[model samples]
Target: MILKCVAIDDEPLALELLSKFISQTAFLKLEGRFSNAIEALSFLNQNEVQLIFMDIQMPDLSGMELARILDGKKNNDKTRIIFCTAYNQFAIEGYKVEALDYLLKPYSYEDFLAAATKAYQYFDRIHNTPVAKSAEPTATQEFIFLKVEYQLVKVMLKDITHVEAYKDYVKVHLKSKANPLLSLTSMKNMEELLPSEKFMRVHRSFIVALDHIDSVAKNVIQIGDHQIAVGENYKEQFLEFLSKWMS
Candidate 1:
């Protein structure tokens, strides 16, 4: 999902940095850049924007005042703000206006990406769009992106054999690869992201793709060369599914 956004900062260099950061992010699109809040307010009146990266301190109109004005506009609730400034003192004030996030000046690209990802998640929930995307999906070609190291690796849903929990991450075992894809995300998150109709959590540490199961033996599930044990807490549900499968 691409979020239409603008940058508002009095300093030319700051606006440049925000513009550069937005360009680097995959999900963000730069709609406009303003050196002051007044011009930005005027432009905002004519255009619809999903987000704003604004400076707190400015001449004539301040970012906080603009946020309040935006809060009053009709059908403007979709637009969110992330304040960028040098002073950390106004952090509370920024949130009081209900800004989505606050970025202190000299923030790195990593920090900016984190805030943008948060915004993406918010939009994704309300819009019912997946944060991860591949090529146009058919009935059977659905896919998702996993953060592997510094890259977002796309994995087709049909290729996922099973998911295993690492200490702080999840290992996505795929049919097309010899090794599992390691991502720095929790198992709980993986469970939520995958469609419930296609993937089932059979253990506290394992989520197996329903179509990939080779056979079920007692409390164990066999998928290719791997044998996964069903936890006691999940055994009943697994059995229920097994009954339905056999019937």
Candidate 2:
């Protein structure tokens, strides 16, 4: 799926470079380019672009302020934003507004591709996958059908040991299978499908099935043959689960 995107930057050279990067990417299509945020916002009001490459600082309207406005809009289309700025101070703030990714100024084509690839994977799942509708987990729902290539493979929730993020896809580890089931979806998608009561995200790249945990030591969880490290961001929640288990 091609993502229709727009770029907004006050710098003529930066805007041209960003547009060039967008054009170099196979899955991204540059729909518009604006030197200021006001014109970009006005164009966005009428256009349905899937992704935006924006500068955080601009005259009249800042990218952050325009993002806030876009968030409040009643339109059905949700456009993901990637903020490009010289200042690194806005990194945390950019994520707070739910920007897809932040690019530091003078970024390489490789860095640009990484951020754009993330957007492509997100849109690919939204437009091409059925997991959004059929994979919603419930208390009694014990199984889910995962799209693998052209066929839907039925996987029992009880058999799941953990879900591992494999680049753009996720590996659904199961007790019954010799190898994990590879699905063309994000870790976020898998987390949404698995019952939260039974599964917990121990790390950004690993979600462990509470029932299948073999051991825990030094912030690492052992499930079967795999040892998954607990990320610092997730440590508090994982420890809370442990405290409950011990109690």
Candidate 3:
């Protein structure tokens, strides 16, 4: 699915850079660009955009204030945000507004691509789009290719102990490796890609291998060293699954 996006930055150079980057991305369509938040706010009020690449600090109105305004709007719930700023101090604030990613200024193309990919995955999940068709495994398929760093690493589904959500990315913990495979994707995407019988989303931030779980205690599923809490929303289904093991 193509995401309609806009860039809001006070700096001409920054706006130009963002416009260029958005143009290069395959799934992103540049709807508009603004040098200040005021014009962007007016544009957003009239038009519908799925994503916004905005600078936090702007003259007259800051991006944070713009986000607050957008958050209050009923029609802007689907508008995802990616904050592009020079200061890393605004990272926490960006999270408060449910931003898809935070691009630290002077970032490289790889960093930008990663953030863009995360946004793509976010939209793909919400819209139920099959953008990553090649990554999807068939019923008989045992492994999947994950884009890690620039390489498509082949990983066996059975080897994954659990999936951990880290901001815009997901860390796939493998039993065969000491380090988990960090990919620029969301937990929702991972949960949808995995087989329902073998893997289950036990928490908003976690998906665990049901067969790999060592025990269940205090609403937590233990898989090796990892302790994943069962979210309140998913607890009923999880408890029903546990009923099969009761004596």
lDDT of 3 by residue, 25-72 (tens): 767799999999999999998899999999999989999999988988
Task: Report the alpha-carbon TM-score of model 3 versus the true structure.
Answer: 0.56
Off by over 4 Å in 2: 75-77, 128-247
Q: How high is the lDDT of residue 95 in model 1? A: 81
Worst 10 residues of 1 by lDDT: 134-143
lDDT of 1 by residue, 91-190 (tens): 9988887888999988876567657766766666557644466464524326666778877666788999999999987899999999999988778768
**Candidate 1: pairs in clash:** none
lDDT of 2 by residue, 141-211 (tens): 55665666644566787999999999977899999888998878778767766668889998889999999
Minimum summed lDDT over a 10-residue window in model 3 is located at 137-146
lDDT of candidate model 2 versus the reference: 0.83
Higher-ranked by TM-score: 1 or 3: 1
User: Rank by lDDT, descending?
Assistant: 1, 2, 3
- Output the lDDT of residue 144, model 2: 61
Measured on C-alpha atoms, candidate 3 has an lDDT of: 0.83
What would the C-alpha RMSD of candidate 3 be, to one decimal place?
9.0
What stretches of model 3 exceed 4 Å from their correct place?
Answer: 129-247
